[model samples]
Target: MRLGTRGPHNPSYVWRSLQSTKELIKKGARKRIGSGCQTKIWGDPWLPDQVNPCIESVCSQGLESSTVSSLRSAVDGSWDIDIIQDLFSERDQRLILSIPLSRQECDDNWMWANERFGVYSVKSGYNLQTNVSDTSPNSPSINWKFVWRLGIPAKVRNFIWRVLSSCLPTMQAFLTLRVEVNNCCPICHNLPEDDFHALVSCPWARSVWNISSIGSYFNSSCTFADWWINITHRRNQNDVELATAILWCLWQNRNDVVWNGKCKSATAIFDSAQTLYSQWKMTRKLHSPQINTEQQTMQERWIKPPE
Candidate 1:
């Protein structure tokens, strides 16, 4: 449905509710150009850029109602370079030229911009909604490329991101959100619960780290992001994986203490992390393609027997 269309004078509750979601749909949906006949050059979200798909260049006086097809050559059905250069800004011209035109005749289509497959899924929608709403000023400057590239489970990586972003449901975070709750650390009961305190400075967390392999490598950074950067930079990949697993398990233990009133000892937590990391490595090894060592050995020995 068109977002700009007006509803009935006395719209039903369901109709109004559905209308409210149009803005969300608008945020995630974009026109996939094919024939480019029906798509508006200025208004439609047809550009290939991920950050801002719609064209940003100011429309010329008479070009307000121009369709994407107007910018194309009628003879070859390709973009008219001279017209494009004259009508759009340099950035817009580059983006417009980059979008490949389909050789065969096809209708323009709509696709979800958030997903690689151009199809909408509830998970992607939920992530988009959360990302849009997460405009907290206290959000930390995290190395998102490093975070996403961690050789760990997706859930663990997501947890690490939430922690670094200050989006975790720690007591201090709740206080920042104006959520009235005890701001004291559940594990320590001394300091305010925050990303750094809960994950790094807590007595229990410190104990867990002290007993772990990467404890000596820990750097004294004031913030969680800085701390993580230091650790990731200094440690090897295997050490980082172990450390991440431990952190994940440590967080899980903290969560259990918060929700279930159950707490495991620091040694138990460390052991759990070791177990988790070992299991994950084993699973990866199992799934990876195997080489026929015997066949390679025989081939190596077969020194071209005189045919």
Candidate 2:
């Protein structure tokens, strides 16, 4: 999990660290071809521990987190000639290397290549070039894992999209609209469709928030984006998690109206989310006595190695 070391290519180390569990990794690769685990090891640049180091390089290069992670996982094992050749095939090798794209271009290249060649086949080709194909014989990375590992891990981003997609009535229903027609605010019926209105500005959404104790903590007319940004950037993990839970409950109420044709109740949603958040925090306190202690210990463990 540390930075790369000088030694034989230890595919096992990368696989074990990224996966962090033997059984999960085994199940993941059970039916895949080639050394499936090796593909994952080669794709990801920053091992679990390599995040900060790799982040430094990406920041220096002005690459976004999602893009950098994707690219890193793409070319990390390219030095393995067998894998490279298989990925390129005899024809592709001649074509791709002949017109070697820049890093940014490579990103698009790999996207298309993965679709056409499949992650497994490309990794197999690379491994074959290095004579390491099926050497260890284990697992392969799926598109979902690649998306998660290579994309932003910011829970807030995921929460935002989830809430928007779930709460927005237009997207939830099967009502067909004109090609030029736009999805607009359901309450105000003016502005473009977005979570901000559904969760923040719409009269109904505001009424729901106002009935809850949480509404008293912020300005009456604040936007959803503002509320989310403030809560996420604050130094409180519990608060962030609580806010997310609240959003989920609010979204669920919206779904009920769409699915069951039932009237929405803001009070019920607020009470449920609040109760859930309180119970979650209480359970965590009871079960995880070491949570606070580990936070302090982690703070103390951070040390700069000698330059």
Ten-residue stretch with the least lDDT total in model 2? 49-58
TM-score of 1: 0.54
Candidate 2 lDDT, 57-136, residue by residue in tens: 21322323233222223455223445445433354334323332233322221111222332435454333322321233
Estimate TM-scores for all models.
0.54, 0.37
- Which regions in candidate 2 have their CA more than 4 angstroms from the true location? 1-158, 161-193, 216-226, 233-236, 286-307
Shift of residue 42 alpha carbon in model 1, Å: 2.3
Model 2, TM vs. native: 0.37
Q: Model 1, 1-307: lDDT tens per residue?
A: 5777888987665787688778778889999888888899988999988678899989889888888988889899999999999878989999999999997999899999999999999989867765765544644444566777767888988888787656788898777655679999998899898888888778899998899868734444567766777788788988888988988898899999999999999999999999999998888888888988887686434467688
Clashing residue pairs in all predictions, respectively, total 0, 17
What local distance difference test score does each model get? 0.83, 0.43
Q: Please give the lDDT score for candidate 2.
A: 0.43
